[model samples]
Target chain A: MAYNLWYWPGIQGRGEFVRLSMEAGGIEYRDCAREEGAHALIENMATFDRPPYAPPYLELDGHAIAQVANILLFLGDRDHLAPSNMNDRYWLHQVELTIADMVAEVHNVHHPVGSGAYYEDQKEEAARAAKQFREERMPKFLRHFEAAAKSNEGDWLIDHRWCYTDCSLFQLVEGLRYMFPKRMKTLEPDLPKLIGIHDAVAELPGIKAYLDSNRRLAFNEDGIFRHYPELDAA
Target chain B: MAYNLWYWPGIQGRGEFVRLSMEAGGIEYRDCAREEGAHALIENMATFDRPPYAPPYLELDGHAIAQVANILLFLGDRDHLAPSNMNDRYWLHQVELTIADMVAEVHNVHHPVGSGAYYEDQKEEAARAAKQFREERMPKFLRHFEAAAKSNEGDWLIDHRWCYTDCSLFQLVEGLRYMFPKRMKTLEPDLPKLIGIHDAVAELPGIKAYLDSNRRLAFNEDGIFRHYPELDAA
Candidate 1:
């Protein structure tokens, strides 16, 4: 049975994290929102009595799970992307949660005042936020990921195998590069392990196929990671 | 064995959410950072082979779990604070994750430009962010929680009995009130279910005792939710 994944059809956004993992795990899933349209996502969300606060919910076996980290946790165990040991699973989740935190910050950099206002209305605040994000926050978060990777003697964030965290890190790097090209270029040399993991994830058979196909959406201004050259720096 | 919870010493902050659950569930745990000092939190984080990106990590049996949502998920089953069914547990987690999202956004309101910079340095940006937060986000998040409560037949966010999500909703309401008193008072009438849950959690015997005791830290400027008169409005 295929899982039904619902998210905004136009942009990768948070949903791409789930898509990356499912693609890597070779899990059969339908990108319902993309196929049906944004109306479908809104209608699908309203159908649930306890509807999700936002999109990127996964429906399988008559149950819908929202929140990227929660959905990954539910799928990790089933798809064998997570460890058998409870401790290892929680630790992996910590890394994923931190990744989510960084992703939120990335979104905030482009919309510093709040998501309610247009980017143009908040450009002045976003510039200040963008400078701080490109200078301090980006490095701090990347260093945390680097330290997590170095903790184990393997290329993966946890255990000696690729898991959901690895897929997320891969998307994060790709998105950051697209969003902050100069900064990522300058920082990539220092993040060898992260770069290596990103390369390894790209080489995965299922992920490679997805990347080559139209299934993988290209980075755009509408997505979480937007490319505003003025918002990025070395 | 008592669990050791490491977090910032002076403020309730994110750790309070974990503290509230432990208090409500009558679980035994030590506030290690509070018992020691800020130095201990720094030292303890450094000692971990795979150190967490930030604090509020629960250490037991030599296993450390970080990230508020991950820690709650780890403890939920063992302490009987989570639903027994897998689907319900995931749903509860989704609510908790959404609560975490609101909490993070709350923090960003005060430190809109950067957490590294002093609030005074970014007060202009923060004022802008806080305006959007008060006018938009607070209602949006509160409505989400209120809707979740209404969807279920029980008073709690998910199950009939109090779960970790209920504990978190309690904290979210308390923090928002402390940080945005005027805004909350204006919004509370529309949020009957959320206010009801907050009052109910406060009346829980364990929570009531903890609230009366010195164990519960008072809200201050150092925490996620800060009271800034200039940043708040009705």
Candidate 2:
């Protein structure tokens, strides 16, 4: 069965989460919106069942699935992105959803006034958002990641088992490093366990291969998480 | 055993979504956060293998699950909140996640400046935020509902299945109507099937009783979705 992934082609956006999972699991899928063009992207959006309030939906068989975390869980379960043990599976999703929650906050650091507004227009608000995000949210998310690491009793979220939470944490650390280089540079030291998880995630065989290859999309301003110089503090 | 639902005590917020599912299913559970007091909510937040970034988590049989949609899906399947068929189950989650996306947007409407800021301070921004929400989001969401209605070969997203999607869609319409009355008044006429679904969900034995009961929290100014007079317009 061929899986069709539809997202704004230019930037990784939310599609990247599902992409990372599919790649890690070696699932074959097409980037539909990229192949079809922006017009097709908008047209497909109009056709979706709940109509994604935004981009990054996956089309399986004929049905389109939106919401990034939901897509990840769907693909994860299909290809073993989480633990099978009930508590472990539940914990894995909590951490993943928390990552999603953090991603939203990271996006808000530069887009506090609404996604429709440009960064330049909201820089003042973005500054305040970034400050709060950097000081409060970073530690909060990292603390959660650290707790999960401890709970797993080793490195990965499920001890010896690596799950989608790891891939997502890899993405979170990568995205945060891209968007807030100086901030992350200073903050990374405090969350040693989270950093260990992030570093370990990068070295995973499938992910290592994917990142080294052309499959990894470079973080750009066009995506949900973007780096703005004024918003980042050293 | 009994389910232990954890969430913030003061507001309907995200916790309400989990509560609705439990209530609709007629499942017995404790509002753990409420009974434990605000201090316990904070204490619980601090303790976890993977601590939730926010509340509205569920402790069922020693496993904790967070995220509004994930919680709904977990409960939906276990408690028959979803259909037994593979296709309908897939579609049901699609609808639930989409409702979650809409809920996120509704949250952005008020917190346009950022979650850290006081809404009073962001009223100017919230006005602009609410404008985009009313002009763009409400219709877009309504159209999605209309299509889902169209997809319903019979009534619900799946003809014979009254799943969590129906309950959530009912809540979305209800919340949207409460939060954006003037806009919904205009949009409702065009979304007949959605309204029908909303009415159908309202009449369900479980939901109908919940709506009339005191256990159902009233929508107030402090929730993720709110009704501010200045923020609403036709």
Candidate 3:
């Protein structure tokens, strides 16, 4: 059965993470907000007895499962995008949760004073946040992911096969490159494993088709990874 | 078998969320950093083949499980702290993860320009961040949780049971009250169900004993929830 995925219409934001997994797993899903409208998504959310706090919730069977990582976890098990063993499954989840932490930090870099204020309003604070993210946080998170990838005897995060975490890592690298081009360029050589995963994921049949189609939203100022020239450093 | 929980020693930060669950569940686990010292926690983290990105990791049966929600999920299943049914269990996890999101945001209020800098160094931005958090973010999160608590037939987040999410919600309310006393005082009346859950969790036999013990670290500036007079408004 096709699932209903509800999110904000325009920007990929967090929703793209779920979309990437579904596409890579070859799972059938409807982009509810894109197909209908953001208003419809909002209305649909309000109707749930246990409503999601934010967007990127998936309606599976009849229930709405929210949170990017949580949605991916369910899909991983259902669609076979993750390892079968319990230990590796939990490991994959741990990696995804860590990726989620970095994604939150990445968003904070552009909205240092918080999301209530616009980036233009918080430019000065964003500059400071961006510097720390580039200099300290970025390397710290990437190195941990690299070590995780190396720990296993394969190119993927958990095992020989590309799991949902690999899809997320690809999105993370892509977003970082879009948000901090100079910083990523300087750091990419050190992150060969992570970069390799991104390249490999791009070549996956389903993901390639998804990326080539209009379904993959372009990175823009409205999304989580907003690019500002002032926030980038070489 | 007892588990070893590694977290920073000084404060009831993210680790406290894990502690609350273990305490309420009556599970035996050593708080590694508090007993052995923070240096030990650091040294131990380095030895993991698939290292956790940050601490609050639990060593169970020779392997480490990281991330608060992921660990809690594992424990929820293993220790009987969550619903046994798959749908309710996933819902419990969704709530816990959303609580995790708010916890991250709550920390960010004090360190809005990023954690590399001190709150003193970013007080100006902190003021802005705190205002938005106290006004918009906190209520938005608490209301969603309140709705979740009310959605079910009983007082807990799930079907009449005190699941791990309830443990987390208790901690969330406690931290908010400590961090933003005036704001929480103003907001608490509207959150009757959530406040009820918090109160109920506090009275649980294990939690009561744990809180009265010295092991329950006091909320301080060093932790995730810090009281700043300037940050709270009536």
Candidate 2 local lDDT, B62-173, one digit each (tens):
4568888778878877888787776666667767767776788789888765566688877887887788778877787778778877876777767675677777788888
Could you give candidate 1's per-residue lDDT for residues B1-234 as a string of tens digits?
788999999899999999999999999999998899999888888777777999899977666789999999988977888877888888988999999999999999999988789999999899989999998898888888889889877777765688888889999989988999999889999988887788889989999999999998899998998999999899
Please provide TM-scores, in order, for all candidate models, with all chains considered together.
0.98, 0.92, 0.99
Answer with 1 or 2, whichever has the higher TM-score: 1
Pairing residues by index, what is the TM-score of model 2? 0.92
Q: What C-alpha lDDT does candidate 3 achieve relative to the native structure?
A: 0.90
Model 3 C-alpha lDDT per residue in residues B1-234, reported as the tens digit of each score: 788999999999999999999999899999988989999999999888888999999987667899999999999988999878878877888998999999999889999886978999999999999998888898898899989888887877777668888989999999988989999999999999999999999999999999999999899999999999999997
lDDT by residue for model 1 over A1-234, one digit each (tens)? 889999999899999999999999989999998899999888888888777899899976656799999999989988887887887888888999999999999999989887978899989889989988889989989988888888777878776789998999999999999999999988988888888889989999999999999999999989999999898888
The alpha-carbon interface RMSD of model 2 comes to 2.6
DockQ of 1: 0.81
Superposed by TM-score, candidate 2 places the C-alpha of residue A31 at a distance from the truth, in angstroms, of 2.8
**Candidate 1 residue spans exceeding 4 A from truth:** none
Say which prediction, candidate 2 or candidate 3, comes out ahead on lDDT: 3
Order by DockQ, highest first = 3, 1, 2
- Candidate 3 CAPRI grade: high
